[model samples]
Target: MTSASELLALRSELTGSLVLPGDDAYEAARTPWNLSVDQRPAAIAEPADIADLQAILRTATAAGLGVTVQPNGHGANGDLSGVVLIRPKRFDLLAVDEQARVLRAGAGVNWGRALERLDGTGLVALAGSNPEVNVVALAIAGGQSMFSRRYGITARSIISVEFVDAAGTVHRVSDADDAELMWALRGGGGLFGIVTEIELALYPGDAIFGGGLMFPAEVAEAVVTAAFELARDEPELGLDVGMMHFPDAPQAPPHLRGRTVATVALVHVGDEATGRAFADRIVAVAEPISDTLTSFTIGSLAAVAAEPVEPMPSADFGVALDGLDDAFAREFVDAFTRGAARGLTRCGIRAMGGAIADELGAEFAAVGATQADALMSCSVLLFDPTIDVDAAFAPMRDLAARYPGGATLPTFLSSGATLADAYDRDVLDRLAAVKQRVDPGGVIRSNRPLG
Candidate 1:
């Protein structure tokens, strides 16, 4: 075991910023984006190089201190008491192989930077709905996206991964080599190892047709009704629709921007003519107050959804359904618009299927429990961090209970305590076994519910 002196010696070997428990920067280093999470880790280590990461890992393992790694601290697992954190501010390696159609990035890189770097290359990675989120954390957590219907989850596009194991060893994992670890890394979150860098398959994103369409609140029901009908037959169009409610204010646009109204953001990753035609059909159902559906690059797609750029206290709840019927679609629209208190909620239901549901014939599983219904993911956010979480979650619990069938999205499950609540028993059991085999001492615990 590493003594305090030995730990100090190991720390001296690193050239990156290291924050100990009582250091001034320690508090900032340990804190996550979600203000509700308050973890007092033993130390926060930022490794400047792969060798430095190896040293930290070895020291932590010898010290018997659990390790928790995060790229940008978006969705940390749980309280990190008595553990150490590996923040990747120092590991910012990015490489793009155009011939291979893949881009490799260090785990610490943010989505916006990656998108900016890959711009004009005719290649784009599967970024999160929000740009500020980290690439590695999102992929490890099995991210969902605006283009999920066409490309599947972020993990599916991963071509290779480089991580440091619990034993303080480095390993490179790919589909052709170390296939088991590759499969586990896809949707397993961070149960197995701490990823240093990951290689992902990039898609051509020169000019994809995608943007938001604003509709009047008066016809939210009719608009959603027609949208559900269009989604049913046009599964091949790679379309995604998100329903939003914006408060009436001068800060919003002149059209439907300032009004507390319903809006849908649509993206058709096809030719401009075909995409514009689909938009025309959608608008025909209900004349929208404003329509901005136009051609855009993949990097700019984040603006269409326009999710908050700043970090805030956020809570998410979801339901996966068996089928999409008019009754269910109407119910979904009503909950976000008519049912919400003051109509102050921003809700979206991504009609997931098509390419995502294709038979990949891999042991790695997909959260496909709902084969009959459309998957509805709901997120509720409060700009102020001081709001009481219990009060905020009360309405969401009620909403989940009111759904046609009650089930949470695995990716949206916020707490480590709710892992089983998100995933089924069989999936949880398999993850537990894999965790046991890889980290026998449970040395790599985080805000994850692997129990």
Candidate 2:
């Protein structure tokens, strides 16, 4: 065990605060955005800058403590015991180059802040539905973004990555400088090192046709079939269909109280006329109870899925599908509706194809290799004080077992999933080689470590 005197000596070398177990701020410091996870880290370090981060790494290594880094902690797993949790929110720097269509964001920057910086520039970053998620983390983990259909996964857009390795050595890597590390960092999770900043390429587009179309629970099967057809027929359009169960809680909207609904959310990158035509095709499938589809600025992209903005406790299970065929669609609709009745709050299947499947070169390869046609996921909020969270997740688990697919995305894999479950043997071997080269000591550890 590290003595208090040693801990204090390590703290003296940093320009940031260190919260031990007894510190008043320790609980909040260790708390992640996903409230369901309870991470009791040995110590929490709030690094003010890169220099402080280096110090923390060196100090932790000297003390023989494993280091885990989290910017906003969106994907926090509950096994952080005996590890030094480093929160680098102080490196919140964002620089946008409109002329070159590039964005350089620090580890502390989130998608919402990056979008704000790119406003009115006729440019958009490949960002996920949750605007508050950390930009660096998402990019490193191969983000599935709003524009994933047109542009591939978000990790392929990275121009460069700046990180400190386990040995406390700083390295700025790109496709040219370190091709192997670049490939691994793109979607290899946080095993190699602690990334401090990333430079990403941005696309040129301002207006997008984006919104949701909600249908009554009775027509969910038909809706899923229609949405699948749309995804297959028009791979250029970004689309996701969600089967939701809204409880009769006081916090829920009055109209949706105690009801199950199927929502088809979409975003098209082209002109408003083409977008309207696509929306019309969906409307032709079934009469929507609510239609919010309209032309909107890219800044408002997060509203397309209507994902909750605030932090909350959530558990999710995901599986990749070869395609959402008629049989699978019916099965999904029935299973989701039944699961909702059993306490599942949200279940969604996102269409994945188009540029996502294209060969983006070995250096740009990410976890979401263009093979899977769709991704199905289920989530539940742990809000009720008396509810059994594990029991609530049972239905979703059964659904996954009944309709198992190829490989799952590392970005959306559950805590129980292993690296082998997300990657092929060849890919896993390559990732392990890279990990051995960069973090041979295994000083840096993440939720999914490359073996």
Candidate 3:
């Protein structure tokens, strides 16, 4: 264990800040974005520059302490203990090469900041719905993109990576320079090294259209089935549907409490007319309680999810599935509703196909569910610490078992999931070998570690 004195000394090595155990600020410093997770890390270090990073690594190696990097702790699992939790928020760097059609972001840079610059550039990155998510985190975990059907997964858009190895060595890598590490970084999670920066290829797009609709519980089945029917074979359109049930409690939203609502959000990487026509068809199913579809640029796409920015206790459960026929859609919606009645606050499904399922030959990165037709997920807030997350997710797991697509992505894995859950046996073995070679002493740890 790194003692209080050694951790205290680490403060002088960093330009940013370090909070050790027993300090008044330790609890808040050690806390992650997912309030459900309880991570009692030994120390929380925020290094401002590359020099500070080297100093941290040197000190950590001497003390036999492993270091894990979390820009904002969006992917915090529950098992962090006795490690130095490094937050790279001070490493803020954002640059776009318009001529080259590439975006370079530092570890601290989030999609919101990047999108702000790309708003009028006629270029779009492989960004996800939540603009608060760090760009590097999304790229490393192969996060599902708002334009994934057009641009593929975020990992495939990676052009290069700048990272610091476990031995305090800094390296800038790409497919041509370090093919193995580059492939691993593409979608192998953050297990090999502490990534400092990344560059993503940008796509041509001056405008993107999206809209949100919220329907009452009465037409939930009809709305769910309509989404699947309209979304099939449409490569440029992305549809994300959700069934949210709010309980009569303080944790629920004030305006939405004691209600079950079916929400639909669509993003189309095309012109205004086609997108509006599609929205009109969705409105014809049943008059929605609310409609907010309109033509806009990629910058305004963040509003579709309208996700909460503040930290909260949340449990995420996800599964990849084969196509759900109309009958199965009804059955699944019924099952999902019943599961939500049990405890799940929201059950979400994203139409996955087009570029997402296209295999990039044999030398491609290790991304999960490359051929999946759809991705289903469930989430529940664990405000009551006594609630068991696994138990709350059991029904969804049972349902997933019946329609298993045989794989799930790392970004969608449950908080307690391991690499095995997102990878095949052969792929996982290759990952293990890479880990053993790159981090022999295991100085670099991840939220989702090799174990």
Candidate 4:
């Protein structure tokens, strides 16, 4: 425990946003997206620079206090007791080198900043399902998206990184330097340290077409079949699709605003003419009540999906499957739709693997071939903050077991309190070894292991 006097002196030494127990913003500062997760840290430090982070690290260690560093509160898990919460919201910096086809963003930067920075460059970075999520945290957690079938998971797109370690030392990790740490940090979350900055491989694209298309629930089987057939051919054309069942919530779109339904969110990452033509092919199968399928630059793409930005309690868990065949699609949708009506779950199945399964043979690979190009990512989402998480996840787990694809991507994983159940043997072993080396004292333990 830090002494009151020590906390006071430490506050004076830091040059950044600092919130103590008595501060009005302290409670808000400790609140994460999961309303159930409440941290009562000795102090919440939003460091202005790397030096400020180093000082906080040394002080916290000396005081026998742990530190929980988060870019955005979306992915935070487990308790943060007797700790100093370090948030890097002040370190927002993004630089794009168009010629090099890479983007460098600071820890504080989010998708909003990345989109703004990538404008006019005719380049698009690997973005998550929702653009409101943090860029670095998502990248490290093995990011996946509807476009993943073409570009591959987000972690494979990283070229280099700058992170601060447990001892306050900052190191640049890349294939050319510190191979082991680079491999570990890629998909291991923030176990090694707080990533200060990252460079991601970008693709040239002034315009790409993609958006949500809602269909009547009755045609789900036909929709899944047509989509699979389209996936077989259109992958070379940068096509990706998702079929999701949303609850009859008020927040849903008017056409899909209520009643159980399967909405297909599709994307074509090519020229405008080709994208529109492909979209026409989709609309040919079944008329969509609401369609946002149109060509747009990366900067304006977020509007294509129109995701919410405010923080709320959420549970995200998924598994890959062989394929979305008619029989399987009908059964899967029926099970989930029935569950959703009872206020048990909201599920989505994202078609995976095309150009994404091409295998770059990069240092950090996400979901090996044995795992990729299977079918779709089957996941459940729930909003009840007090929902019984373990019980809620059980049905999904059983459903995943019925499918053949093994190993769930780490980024889509939530509440993985158990190591063995959370990861397969290979990943579990590698992650455990990396944790041992980087955080030897086990000082960094969150939902995922630090050591």
Candidate 5:
């Protein structure tokens, strides 16, 4: 354990604030976005700039302590004990190069702020469904966005990364500077170092025809079948489908409370007329109870899923499927409904093909190079203390076992799986070599540690 005097000495060298275990701000500083994860680090440091970050890393290394980086604490896995929790919330930097069609964002910049900054610029950054997620973290984890079908994974769009390795050496890594480190940083889950900033290529076009179509619970099987067929027929169309179970709670809206519904969300890059025609094809297969498809700007894409903005306790179960056949679709629908009956609140599968498979080269990045047609995930809200978490996840596990395909994406991976489960042997070996070279002491700890 680090002594109080030693911590004070280290704090004196930093321009940022450091909170000890007994400090009033310690709890909030160390808390993760997922309320279920209980992380107890020895200290929490919020770096104001790159200098402060480097000092923190050097001090932690001298003290023989591990370092865990959490920009917004979205992917916390509860393994932060006995480490120095570094939150770069003060590193507020955002720059757009319209001429080059690129965006340079700091670790603290969220998708919401980035989208707002580029509102009417006729340009869009590759971002995920939840606008509140940190842009740097998502890019590092191989972000799957609304435009993934046309543009490929967000990691592939990275132009450069500015990070500080475990030895306190800062590096501006790119394909030109260091190809191996850059590839590892993309979708490798922060195993090498702390990423302070990232530059990503942006896409043109400001608008997309996107929204969701909700159907009654009774017709969930039909909805799933239709959604799979649409994705198979038009791989270029950005699509996702889900079966949500709203619990009977006062916190939920009156209309959604105690209801089960299936929804097919669409995001078409083509013109409004073509998007409408695609919607018509889906509706013709099975009429929807509620349809909100319309022409919208890229900034409004986050509203399609309407995921929760506030932090809450939740557990996730996910799987990658080779293809969604008729038999698999029926089994999936039945499993989802059964899990819903057993307290599974949200379950969905996002289509993964087109640019995701075609553009993701085997050696390009650590993720997104999958042969799977779609990725399915089931999540259970843990608001009720009496709920059985294991029982709620059983159906999802069984469903995934039925159609296991290639490795799972790092972004959707949950705890308990080894690195081999998420990557092939060769990729794992390469990642290990990078980890050994950059972080030999294994001071940089992440959810999926290659070291």
Candidate 6:
């Protein structure tokens, strides 16, 4: 173990600071963005620069420890007993090369910042719903975007990665520079090294006609029908349908308060008429109480889902399906109906066809969702930490068992999930081979590792 004296002395070498076991801030420092996660790293280090990062690696080597990075900790694992957590707070760098049509952001930059920066630039990158998630993290973990139908997944958009290997050596890795490492960096879940920054290819953007419509829970099947119909016929639209049970709390949106509603959120990268006609299919199913579907610039893409930006205790259960059968729609709706009064807050099914279903390059990262046709998930969000997990989500687990299928995206993997849940056996073996070659001693770690 790293002695207390050595750990204390190591702090003096950093421009930032460190919080060890006994420090008052240690408890808060180790907690992840998802308050439900409880990880106890031996120490938490805030590396101001590359030198500070190396210093932590040196100390970990001396202490016989593994190093892991969790800048925002959206995907924090259950246990981190022997690892040192490195929070790259100062790695916040966001730059856009308009002429080249590229985006270079450090690990600290979140989707919210990137979207705000590219607001009216007539350029759009593959970004997710939750704005607070780091852009680098999302892309590296094989992000699913509102534009996936046209642009593909976020990982495939990565042009280059600035990484620090297990030896604490900084290297700029690209497809040409290091094909093997670049392949792993794209979607291998940060197991190979610690990335400082990444360059992403940006796509052209115009005003988008997108938003959401909330229908009564009784019409959920029709809304689901509309979702799959669009996924099959309209390959250009981006939308997701979910059954949500909003709590009757002061913090809850007044419109969604104390109701179990079926909501369809979407974005069509085209004119208003085209988007409205697509939405009308859902409207034709039943009269919606709430409709916010409108035309806006791609800059406002993050606002479509209206996902909460705050942190709370939440449990997510997800799975991938090869293809949905005729029975799935009823199975999904009926399962959640029995679950809502119990604790299942929201269950959603988003079609993942088109470019998203297209395979990554043979040499690129192994993102399993690209092979699957759709992604489904159920989540339970509680206010306090004392929530009974098994009691709250047992029905979800039972429901998940009913759908025997393929793999989920790494980002959608349930808590305590291993890489095996997101990749096939062959892919797992390939990732393990890469891990052995790049991190022989297992010096670097991430939320999801090959182990």
Question: Cα miss at 81, model 4 (Å)?
Answer: 1.9
Error of 6 at 56 (Å): 0.8
lDDT of each: 0.68, 0.81, 0.81, 0.68, 0.81, 0.81
**Candidate 3 ranges with C-alpha deviation above 4 Å:** 250-255, 384-391
TM-score of each: 0.87, 0.95, 0.96, 0.89, 0.96, 0.95
Poorly placed runs, candidate 2 (over 4 Å): 1-4, 366-368, 385-395
Runs of candidate 5 with Cα error greater than 4 angstroms are: 1-4, 359-362, 416-418
Residue 311 in model 4: lDDT = 76
User: Which of the two, 1 or 6, has more TM-score?
Assistant: 6
Error of 4 at 205 (Å): 2.0
RMSD of each: 3.3, 1.8, 1.8, 3.0, 1.7, 2.0
lDDT, candidate 5, 272-371, per-residue tens = 9989988887788777878888887766767765767898888877778766887877887788788877788888888988888884364767774667
Q: How do the candidates rank by TM-score, highest first?
A: 5, 3, 2, 6, 4, 1
Give the alpha carbon lDDT tens digit for every residue of 1-451 in model 2: 4645556787888888889888899888988888888899888988887787788778777787888888887778766877888887888889999989999999988888887778788888998867888899988887788698888888888899999998888999998998888888888878888889999999967778878999998888888888888889888799998789887998689999999999899989878898888878778878999988888776777766667877788777877876468887787877777677667888888888888877755346647464787887788877876666566667666766766668767777775566676788888888889988998888898866653
Clashes of 3: 0
Better structure of 3 and 4 per lDDT: 3
Higher-ranked by lDDT: 1 or 2: 2
Error of model 5, residue 289, in angstroms: 3.3
User: Over the stretch 123-231, how does candidate 4's per-residue lDDT look in tens digits?
Assistant: 8887864667788888887777556666777777888999877788888888888767777766777767767899899986776787877777777666656666666
